[model samples]
Structures are given as structure tokens and as C-alpha cells.
Target: MKSVKGHLRNRLVKARKKSAGQANIWLFYSFKLDADVPIIGDLEMLYWVSELETQPQVRRFTMEHEVEISLEELGDSFEEITVTRVEHIDGSIEFHQVASKQHDSFEKVSVPVRYKIENRIEKSHLVVIPAARLKAFSKSSLSFWLKVIAFVSQVRGYDLRYEMGQVGTSISICGDGTIETLLESLSITDPALAVGAVCRSVLQGNIIVDGLRSFGRNTRWRTP
Candidate 1:
């Protein structure tokens, strides 16, 4: 009986290897905001906290080498944040909050809110990337470049920069404006060309229609 079991296990493993072939690699990009960023309106806050998922897929590719190649090409132009907690509430005026601490900061604070979709809003612009994407780019140089572009796209509302290294990618979000200012900055001088460019870029990344941002570790929160 033991011998038969061992044989079956071996056969199963071989079958899986044959059928599964290679894993489809993907990167999960996420952004975590401070719950108090004020720019996020009620509707946008709800969607960000309640409706939107914490994880966003910035890009995907089959070959690990290709991913590394992309990251290298981009280099020092992406960002990453880990969110500790997020919440939403319904009342006369709906609101949401997110609390977190980044490596660069000594303490956590509530970020101003900004209107997103509907009455929902985002306390802060948070983005996440999945483990799959990491594996794809594990041995490539281009992974860093790809990450930079994806990070920039995700936090279009912020003044952000990407830092690249052989070790990994880093993103920095700058806070230097009000919600109105942020929105104004995003105003496309050429809407048609801007829209076309965004569409094309998104397609290149193979991002899903319902792609959402994922929160990260070290997140903390309070509800009222």
C-alpha cells in the first residue's frame, strides 16, 4: 500500500508539471492612503474604502527574464506603500479613514481625503503589487522600469517619484497641495491625447477592467 501511494504521488506531481507548464506571473501594485487626506469626497471615499480592492495589477508577463528586463529599463521610478487599516461610514456626510506608517516617516497621520468615483473618496492614494509579478521579474533588470511607470500611473494625482535598485523598487508620494490643487494638476490640457495615451498604457500592462488597489501590512485604524 505504501509503495502504491508513493507511485501515485510521483505520477500526480509529474502530471501537474506537464499540465500546468509554467506559472503565469503577475505583479500586484497597491497604494495606502492616510484616512484624513480631506481631498477625497464622500462618494470617492466610500468607493476607495468599501468598494475598491487593495491590490492592483500593474502588469504581467510570462518570462521572468522579460519582467526583469522591463524593470531595469524603467529603473528608480516606482513606489510602494503598506497600509495598516482602512474604514468607511455612512451618515449625514459619509466619510472614510486610513491610517498607516511608511518607512520614511517616524509616525502615522490621517491623510486628507479626495473624491474618487461616485460619492466615494480616497483618504490617500494607495497602490499594491502581487507576489506573482515579483517572481516574474526576480532575475530581470527591466522589472524596475515597469514598476516606475505603473506607480506613476496609479498615483496620477500626486507628485511622486520612483527609486530603483538591484534589491527592489521604491515609491515616494509628495504632499504639497490641496485637493483642488491636485485635481487641477491632473487636468489634461489635451484630453483626447491624454485619454488615448492612458488607454494604450493600460492595455500594455494587461490590467483587468476591475483592477483595485490592495492595502499592506502595519496598517492601523479607528472608526466613528
Candidate 2:
């Protein structure tokens, strides 16, 4: 009976190998985010936390490599996050994040956030850039930024310089005006509005106001 059982097991293993072709395969899964919510860099951390909630029962696994997901924001809201796992011969696994799908969503209107940079040293201009875009920029070299000159010219006075240590491209006001000067000249009382306006100018390549205000605050060279 034992000899028969061993023969059957051997046959089953051989069958599996022949039919499957490969001895083992990497595992992967699809992850999706709700369409109504905005896609933010920090949201990835939320997903990581949610996965942790399934601990113990799910069994903890050691990751062989760090995960990275693409951060290209679509005009519409349907965004898909893909997680990939690679199995290695040494019993190690690698995980990666991928942005694979997108669709339109009418439930939510994306808005620029007024984020305060704690201990911000550069007093010239407030830099606001999507974290994912910043990561892409970091991976690139100086050649990647050459085209930015024409796009930045649309903003008027600011020069787009690449900072190797920084997360995103920053326009350090070539002129003298600071945030306070900008608010005063534009007759803008609210700081949030000012931040939004500045953020829009940096992102959209142009500001809505007319004359000097039309070019936005970046062009304003203050009186020393």
C-alpha cells in the first residue's frame, strides 16, 4: 500500500511539472482605489496600512524589494494601482507598485491643497508639486529638464532650475518679491487664495489675473 501511494505521488508530481511547464511562478494582484477620492502620494501609505489590518491570519511575508507605484494623474478619476510579486530561488520575494488603469469619475473634483511646508528655508517661493511627479524627476537627469524652459517661460519671470536633492522642480523667484509682497500687490487678503493662485501658476503655466497680476506673483521683482 505504501509503495502504491509513493508511486501515485510521484506520478502526480510529474504530471504537474509536465502540465504546468514551469516549476514555480511569481504572484501578482490587482489593487484599486475608490474613484470619488483624490489620488495623492500619501494615499499609498493608507493602502499599506489597510493591508496591515489583515495581519496574523494572512501570515506575514518578508518583501525582497521595495514597492514603487507610478503617479501619473489622469484628467478623470478612475485610477488603478497594481501590485506585482516576484518569487526568487532563495525563497525571497519582490514587490512592486504599478499604475495601470484609469477612468473618468464625476463624483469628485480634484483641488490643489494648501500645504504648509514645516521649517521651509527657501523664503523666495513656495514650491508645490505632486509627490509622484517629484519621484520621476529625481530619477531623471539634466536632459529631462531642458524642455521645461519653454513651459516655464509661460510663467513669465521665474527660471526653472533642477535641484538634485529636491523632490520637484522649483522656481526660485529670480525677482525679489516674497509671498507677502505678492499678496499685497494682488490685493489678495486670503493666504489660501494666494497659495492656490501660486500653485496654479506653477502647474498650469499661466495665471488668470490681468496685467502684472496676470503673470502671477513669480514675476514680481520687489524693491530692495
Candidate 3:
């Protein structure tokens, strides 16, 4: 496979010529850069990053890996870690060696990303997905979040976003409350379903969540 930079650059150069989905560019706002960054990834990653930006606890995000790797050494498919941020509330930006996902999904306890350039291996301090509050990064937690992120970001994304468009207007008018309470007022009974809707709104930049820590029914939220 071609290098990440090379592939993206080539795609960008011929962007206008490429048909439909091939040329679709995603612009994501980065708190760290204080500007919109061009995002390239699948819908799951796009949704994950978007959700992170809305949470109060999240300070910023940084790409973990965007470098060349040796296909001969690492094979056709290696871990292509993108943006990652430490979970600690330091008010300081830092990325470090994080453990590889035993299950998939990052919450804490980071591991290093290894890549090859010109047949030389290099290490990058890109934290994998990290949840707030330092811990060993549970397998179960990772699996759950990974499943949720994957599903909401990919599988049911379209339907959810369409629903969120309507839900967001109601949420903005409904006033402030935890995700649970607000959805309850709207007669949305399922907490999981409610969280997904609110989260979709958050991604759409219509509504806002008060916190990113342990996002659930009790998570505080508001409209912007």
C-alpha cells in the first residue's frame, strides 16, 4: 500500500476528477489547532472524533499516526492509528506510548505506535483511544465503546442523524437537563436510544453535552 501522506495527497490532487464518494472531503474542527483540519477516515472514526469535540472534559485531539510504514515488514494491514488524546485532565497536551487494543477502543494506558520509513522502524507516542479517568483500560469497556462507536458511527448513522435533526430542535427548545431527563420529557423511553440521539445531535453541532466522562443517561447536556 502507498504511504498515508502520499495516498491522501494523490487523492487530493485528483480530487476534482474523482467521482462522488472518492472525492468527498471531511473538514473537522480541532480545538488543539484552533482551526478546521481535513479529516480522512471511515465514518466510525469521523463520528468518534466529532463526539469527542462536544464533550466538556475533552480538551483537544491530535493525530496519533500519519506516516509511512513498510508493507514488507508489517504486512498489508497494520494498525492505522489516527488522532488520539490522553484522557487525563492536565490542561496540557501530551501523547504517549499506549497499549495496543486488546479488544478495540481506547480509554487509557496508552501504547506506542510503530511504523517503518525506508525500512527503518520508528516509534510514535500516539495514545490509542483513552477514556477519561486513568485506569488499566478494560477489555470489556473497550469492546462496548468500540461496538457503540462503530454502530452509531457506521451501521445506524444515517437513520440516527435524520432523527437527530428533528430531535435537536426539540432539545434546543426543551431546555437543559441530563440526557435521560431531557429525552424523558420528549417521551424517548430507551436510555440507550436517547443517548444515541443526543450524541448524534452533538456530532451535528446542533446540541451540546455538558460532559464526556462516562457518557450515559445521567450525562448533563444543553443546546448551543
Candidate 4:
């Protein structure tokens, strides 16, 4: 497999060529827990780093793995991981990775995506939250949001699908109204941000992410 840096650099070069003459490039991304395929425990933290590219108006986002310990070596220190076959197709991102050399367990996670034009030009923000908190928030908030979307879609006669991505998660609805319409009518923030408050609370040391295994378990979410 190619190094993460090499793969990213190659993609970036091609992206630059496509969006030539664009003086500034803004990248917006986030770190999210993959609840569909939950990680082991509090001792290990695994997440995906998703990048949103602008100027080229690409629909697909590039994603890579971010873990608390190196997959090659198990330790508390952070390290880079090499993922195989990173590619964007249609409205989804697909990639595969082996968590660690010792584990040697290959896993693939894919999810549908919708690029927001507004986020592209904005500065990237780093979310400071513990891995446990992230897992808790992702599990709970995703479950609630998915349920809400499902219920709403059923009543409104629309088609709804829950998609988990490397770094983000979304509830896609198609029918009488679009996601934007639902958001506007419901006055709820983006489903991706449903856990923002909870995550921030964890970062502020006000909450601990324990006993959060119930979120998203009830629904039949698509897995990579």
C-alpha cells in the first residue's frame, strides 16, 4: 500500500491541476466515530479524518485513518496509518485499513456524502474531544437523528437512508422535500452537528462518555 502522505499528495496535485489558478484552498473536515463498526474500548481510539475540497467542486471527499496509537506499534503516542484503496465514488467515500500490524484485521468503511458549498470556503476547525466522548456522542446522536429522520420520512412519504463516512455521518432523505427543506422546517442543525454540544461538554470536562452503547443500535444502519 502507498503511504498516506504520498497518496494524499498525489490526489492534491491532481486536484490542484483541476482547480488551477485558485489562489486559496480551504479544507473543512471533522473527526467522527464509526459506530456501525464500533472500536474495541476506551484503551484504543480510532477515527477517520475526512477532507472536503473546494474550488474544484468535487462531490467526493478524501478520507484517512487517525488513531491514538500507531497500527504498526501499539502505544499511547499518536501515529500515522496507511490505508489502502482510498477513493471517492458517486456520493460516497470508500477505503480499507488494518488497525495494527499485530491485529492485522482489515476493515472497510464507506458512507454517502453531500458537499456543502458554504463549508468549502471556511477555515477548518479542530474539535478537541476525547475518543470516548466522540464515541458516545456519535452513537447517541446518530441514533436519535436517524430515528427522527426515519420517522419523519415515513410520515412524509420520503425515502431516507443513513450513511456513515470516514469522518462524518449523514441522514439522506429524498422525496417530497430535500435535506435542506427538512432542516429548515424542523429548525434543527445539520445531523452531523447533533452531537456538537455533547462533544463540547466532554471536551470541557463536564461529562464522561460511559454507558453509551445504545445509540444507533436499534436502526439497521448500512455498514462498510
Cα error of candidate 4 at position 139, Å: 5.4
Candidate 2 lDDT by residue in tens digits, 112-141:
211112442111111112234423333442
lDDT of candidate 3? 0.45
Each candidate: RMSD: 22.5, 22.0, 13.5, 18.0
Better of 1 and 4 by TM-score: 4
User: Model-by-model lDDT, in order?
Assistant: 0.26, 0.28, 0.45, 0.28
lDDT of 3 by residue, 1-224 (tens): 86534433332211122123554466644433445556443332333443354344555555443343222334554443233443434564334322222434334433344554466666543333333222332322333333334334442423554556557667767767776676666545555565566655654445565333455667677777
**TM-scores for all candidates?**
0.17, 0.20, 0.35, 0.19
- Give candidate 3 misplaced runs (Cα > 4 Å): 1-158, 187-194
Model 4 TM-score relative to the real fold:
0.19
Q: What is the per-residue lDDT of model 4 for residues 111-154, given as tens digits with 9 covering 90 to 100?
A: 22122223332111112123443354455544443333233223
Q: Where does the lowest 10-residue lDDT sum fall in candidate 4?
A: 49-58
TM-score computed on alpha carbons, candidate 1: 0.17
Give the CA lDDT, 0 to 100, for residue 196 in model 3: 64
In Å, residue 117's CA in model 3 sits off its true spot by 19
Model 4: residues with Cα > 4 Å off, grouped in runs: 1-59, 63-80, 83-130, 148-224
